[model samples]
Target: MLRKHLLYLTSDHLFAYLWQAGSLTPGPVFGADAAGLRAFALWLADGDTAPACLLADLVEEEFQRQLMPHVGGHAGRQMRRRRLHQLYRDTPYRHASVQGRASGGRRDDRVLFCALTSPAIVNPWVAAIERQGVPLEGIYSASLLSGALIRKLALAQPHLLLVTQQAGGLRESYFEAGQLKFSRLLQTAGHDGMAAGIAGETERTRQFLASIRLLERGDLLHTVILAPAAELDALRPL
Candidate 1:
């Protein structure tokens, strides 16, 4: 059976990644984002060939996460927005922000409330996709995708960091109690030694986690590395 297409959008293009159940099909088209947009428009022109569920990753969106005491109902949402507003007060994209939450624990009092803003990047995409026949089921940040991998692996470490290479760079997402606490994307250079470059970034990420108190001094930070097997092998000895 054919799988639903997962679209991951960058500044100039969208990728249609085939995903069925929990697995993927290779050779995801690089131009699928633009193609999908056109197809969606055509589908709207008629009434056929519209996807019921579409998953998207907005790569250019910026993430700002804050911790807040657990509160319920509309008041909680308001407080979260207020905090988000304050956080982005100086940012140019303040008005074009999206918010989400990653719960720490069932009874945990603290929750990580996240805001992603990139009006220049997100607004156009939203405007393009809205009012179309497609459901446009969910929009997500690329960093958050690592959380799904952690869950799939059933990792139980309290302070774990997941490192994956994407778009010619290394993306790190730190998780605590299955919730994404922090993330960073580092650009790559000089691909002559890919392994060493990745290793350096990995160390930098570890220090960053410590500097931010996400990984405290004397804390054991379990790292989950995702890269080519050869690259991973070289990193293993570091």
Candidate 2:
């Protein structure tokens, strides 16, 4: 049986987990420090070379939405690479994806460029993985995973706002016509008054969308909160 590894990375720590036979076993947590990085490398050296998927939930992640001239084949990929480099020159952890095509005359493709702006936080961890010869499947962000979650849940809202509580904090992702348009993270101090906090953040996010013209005046905004059953029960009233 092939065992899979999952790494949840935040600014403060990296949590490792083992997945086998549909069960997940928690592993050691490595803090974001010199000693922690060294320990992580040593741990990897002793563990099996199972392919790992890194999920980063960081405040430094950035996203930009733009419409680019539609092109295809090799040239299109080259163009996107150049654009992504131009957008985030300092970070190697950058990705670009074409969401859809615009409706207007040129019908340009809608591109979303995302990156972890602060390489200082992620480089050490990646370097450790490289030094240990670990096969990293790919690095993903919480916001990116939320899109997958929406698809898995079969959410078909045209204008949707998805809020999720993660170890790092509250992640709010906004989608237009079922495509992710924007996302932001808010770090809460504690679990106290979490429901109120969610309500306040949702309203603020809605206002931000309207200000950016993403949400039209008086248009309906469908908001979905993803959490465990206990958390959902607490949030249901708001």
Candidate 3:
């Protein structure tokens, strides 16, 4: 059995050892859920080191320390709950940086990584984690993360990735699969119903894919939506 449990961190929440149906390691992370934020690296703290629950309490006093008005608000209080046993989902899509670290029985299969969030949060957190010497292999946003998870489930390599935006227009691109495939961040009506949101996102993704064909189109790889279908109709199969 694995002796050391994994830690999954993100902007909103933190979870230790994320999985999907006992399948793969390096599972997807939900940017909106505070519980999915794995802000700290597992190696940063030894297996026995306990997180300071006081940190949550300390946050309320931070505004005063900054010489700003004290908001007297509790921020990041629930991350340190030692007794939360239901933190992990029952899936094999676990995420980790250290290659051999996540090795359960198969020492050959590589772990996948997906990070979905704005640069403001993802960038700084990534740097912070790296500075602290947290090990990792890949990183992507929630939308891409979700998509990547789907691809893993399908046992296919993703060719394209899509991200949703509330406003500020749309953006898209690709990372590992050369320049042919890409990822996109676009403004869609998240608050709007489902069909509209899915249609908008799907349209944007299609445009980007079609445009990429101008340069050189091989075959469509993969497209994913950050929001679940229940929240908003997901843009899949693009």
Compare the candidates by TM-score and give the number of the best one: 2
My TM-score estimates for the predictions, one after another, are 0.70, 0.94, 0.34
Worst 10 residues of 1 by lDDT: 90-99
Supply the global lDDT for candidate 3. 0.35
Quote the positional error of residue 40 for candidate 3 in Å.
5.6
Compared with the true structure, what per-residue lDDT tens digits does model 3 show for residues 1-238?
Answer: 3223243433243334533355435423334233323424433444333221100000001000001111222421222121121222332222222122223443332222322222344444445445655444444233334335545545344455444432222334343342222343444334444445555565555665567452246656454445545655333432
Q: What pairs collide in candidate 1?
A: 14-33
Between the candidate structures 2 and 3, which one is better when assessed by TM-score? Answer: 2
Q: Estimate, for each residue in 1-238, the C-alpha lDDT of model 2 and write its tens digit.
A: 4798889998888999997887889999998998998899999999999998888999898889899999988999999999999999999999999998999889999999999999998888888888888999888888888888899899988899998887788889999888888898888764555676898889999999999889998789999987776676788888
Q: Rank the candidates by TM-score, best first.
A: 2, 1, 3
Candidate 1, residues 47-87, lDDT tens digits: the string is: 43334333334434455454465677887768766776676
Better of 1 and 2 by TM-score: 2
Specify the highest-lDDT model's number.
Answer: 2
Q: What value of lDDT does candidate 1 attain over all alpha carbons?
A: 0.60
The Cα RMSD in angstroms, rounded to one decimal, for candidate 1 relative to the true structure is 5.5
